[model samples]
Target: MESVSRDLDMPDDSNPLRRLSLEQLRRRTSMKWRTYPHDVLPLWVAEMDVPLAEPVAEAITDAVALGDTGYPAGTAYAEALAEFAHKWWGWGGLAVGRTAIVPDVMLGIVEMLKLVSSPGDPVIVNCPVYPPFYQFVGNLDRPVVEAPLGPDLRIEFAALENAFRSAGRGSARGAALGAARGANRPVYLLCSPHNPTGTVHTAAELTRIAHLAREYGVRVVVDEIHAPIVAAGASFVPFLSVPGAENGLSLMSASKAWNLAGLKAALAIAGPEAADDLARIPEEVSHGPSHVGVIAHTAALRDGGDWLDALLRGLDDNRRLLASLLAEHLPSIGYAPAQGTFLAWLDCRDLGLGSDPAEAFLKRGRVALSSGRAFGTGGEGFVRLNLAASPEVITEAVRRMASAVV
Candidate 1:
């Protein structure tokens, strides 16, 4: 990997693009005191410390200039999404007609939950998952069934099947009642290119999961926000694209990949039966999507490909650099560059961090990162690091970490 000094075309301090440096990001964002101090590097949050593409900026400016900030008409946004799906994922001219566009990823998940299940129902979640998955279920009074993970953080199929079968009659009853009452239950929240761990389930794995869901008569709500940012050699498999996954629902967004998270645009693609159910969700949700979000998302889909490509290259390089650094400085730590997502799950059990290195890195090294415990049971003794920043930022983070551990 090239050094930031050689590779990056440093922006002038006067330009917003130039202000994208770690120095400026610390000043502009409130992350300074909370995580990375003025001097320490930050590898914590999912947000990339990068500037918006010129096209994206232009679209937002153009929208505001025209005073067109009112709620967007659904047709154009839906078409833009359809085009992106076909162009990128080979989902072949799949039309997303009159879909309910929510404010953000979590909101979309909640909406899917609303469409499928009622309060106090059961939601199946894999352990060592993104923390929000647990909170989302708990907030709704939904009993969460813990699905243990394999050593690699991939789904333990046998355990998941057992959980689905014997998770309790309370769970089974809810599913059956939801099917009869026009509400769905026992929904499995599937994370594609899963967060924290960055494990991308293969098509075969997804097929097996779908078959199990089919046999158990449960619904699958897949969160695929990280699909667009996968490493170059990796291909993302959309759960709905797999055969026998006809009843599954897919959730995606430009937020994670394109750094449009604050703009709050996300999509929910449901199969035939699921789509019908989503369409019948209260009309109030029809307006949940912001006009600004739609505008930003449309612009990103229409003209953001070059920027996305560049980002993928930059992220891939950063991922490799960190992996290499870990291999050299912390030889005892074992990890591979994840096939998708900018987040890397560092196995720190060899370091003897005792289940929470995130705290040690912060208190001693002044480097802040998400604790593995935040992900769930199996996440202990590991740490999740975001490598979406400039190469210098990532390099500095590694340096700080090395100093503390050694």
Candidate 2:
């Protein structure tokens, strides 16, 4: 691998994404780097091209040095998250007693779905979302119903209500029992600071969703892994903090914000009213979290705040940089600045790349972007680019994409 030094456009030294050179990043054997050929500028997957936070690295190293590898134990993860949440989002209601440790965000979401809905029940998701929402829910034998987001990439309340009604038809038992029971109800899997599009759902939107869920006897399960990655103007509202959300469940992890996805640990938090439902989770599910993962995640939530802030700033810069690069190099492509998450959803319909623009980018430009079709409805003729990279790489990716178009 050839060494590539920092570009003048890179963020300041405090930005973790700028810490590693291209060669150093290529040395990583993670899915992000290894999935593509040597020449391909991979901007797919959720992995961040950044070094681990010092606190996270230290915690993991110390644990390994002490040979402290064992099954996860204690409420440390939940407690750390509570502190982080309170400090960052002004959420003071994270009851550690109502939380459970799960392997990761997606698995935690799957388990949460199982807790509220039975096999063959409908699981509703906003389309053009994380593809796993469909895969995991389908693997559990639950059918996935799509409620596509509105043109603004925000949740569509009417579409959501329609999905809720459609899903409720199959759960007559739950609807008949009313919202209080919440048994045999359809599960609405929400991606906060939504993936692909990076739309930060406002508190008002979340509260309305909670109200609708209550009215339709739909259970809301939120994937809040990107909770800590919101940009400056956007506020991340924990689904559980909103009114009428006492029956909702949320899965949070420090993985996305801290770039600790390889270390699998997440928290499944229940609303006060849903504690009984959470308690029904299989005990074996708790065994899924790695002890080291717990330690790393705890350290991240507790001690990695400054690093997270720096990363967010870097991401903000990268998102803006991408906008300029696209405007200059790929002028026909449409991209809205993301409110959160390090992903950019690009509209490639005008590029005439047909349904899957990622294929053309990969083959012609040697740039790997996430296929929009895999994200389901409203995703075709689009591509999801991972913006958690050096400014130079992002620039080069856009140049390559433009070349492919030409």
Candidate 3:
């Protein structure tokens, strides 16, 4: 563990994001750095290359200082999340009583899925979604159907309707009811502020999704880990906040915005009518979340807003810098600037890099990126780039990419 600088205290006006030089970042022992050789620049994981938010750091440090590391128990984390949601998204309907602590976003999503559907059921998802959506759902023995996004990177309701209808075609019976029409329901694993693409879904789109779920006997569970990272002109609509979303559940965390993924804390919130289903999760599962994670995430939600805002500003600059770099060095690679999270999805089909462009980038360019093919349908000839690095690193990466293609 390297010593974090005290300069982490929020400066009145300075780009905190770019402050870390390459040498300093390498000192980190995390998998993001240790996975690749010394020469390779690893940008495949969702981890940001910025310093931890001061409040989150202090919270963890304080807990350690007091020797408070133990099993987690309480309503503090849930209440903090409720307050943050109300203050930020104007989601006034959030009830702390309806929330449950989970180990992390993915695990929470898995648990929520179990509550709504049984094994051998059907799970619907948007294509080119987070790879874990496929992995986790399959782990539960559920069938997955894809609804690819439209050209504008927005939800395609027609595709969703087809998948929803298709997913609900089995005969009525215990677990089969989950995928059966006229009774029971299938699960729609939605990724809001969707991963890989970073497109912030609009309220109208969410409302329609909710209505579709209602009409087709489908249950909705939204992965909203990136909800708090929305940039200008884009507002995140909590799935539970939609009119017809009373049967949906949303999994969120302070991990993404505050860069606290290692903390291992997350929450699964249910809509008014669906709270009972989520409450059925066994108490034994609650023991999975770390006590330190609760302290760190609670502190982040309650006091890390200013730090998050500063991060959003820096990420905004980094997003534009990436666009400029791509335009200057690899004009043929199509990039749609992300509206929320610090991720850039590049269209590399034109580069003739075969099915997986990340392979060429890693081997020839010494830069690691997330391969698009693993993201399931509609992902061929694409790659996901992490835009959470310093401007110099981003520029150097593009330069290397250009060199590889030429």
| Top lDDT model | 2
Q: What's the true lDDT of residue 406 in model 1?
A: 53
Write one digit per residue (lDDT tens) for candidate 3, span 122-234: 89989899999999999998889899998878899889998877776432233254444434458999999899899898889899998877767788999999999877777
Per-candidate local distance difference test: 0.77, 0.90, 0.85
Candidate 1, which ten residues in sequence have the lowest lDDT sum? Answer: 12-21
Q: What would the per-residue lDDT of candidate 2 be over residues 1-406, giving only the tens digit for each residue?
A: 1223446334457888888778778789999999988999889999998888999999999999999999999999999999999999999999999999999999999889878888988899999999999899989999999999999999998999999988874344557675456445688999998998999988899999998887777889999999999877888889999999998999999999998889999999999999999999999999999999999999999999899999999999998999999888888999989898989999999998899999999999999999999999999999999999888788888888988985
Positional deviation of 298 in candidate 1, in angstroms?
1.1
lDDT of 1: 0.77
Candidate 3, residue 355: lDDT:
97
Candidate 1 runs further than 4 Å off: 1-19, 30-36, 168-178, 181-184
Clashing pairs in 1: 116-184, 355-381
> Model 1: what TM-score?
0.91
Query: Where in model 3 is the C-alpha error above 4 Å?
Result: 1-13, 169-184
Model 2 C-alpha lDDT versus the unseen true structure: 0.90
Q: Which is the better candidate, 2 or 3, if ranked by TM-score?
A: 2
> Regarding TM-score, does 1 or 2 come out ahead?
2
- Residue 76 error for model 2, in Å? 0.7
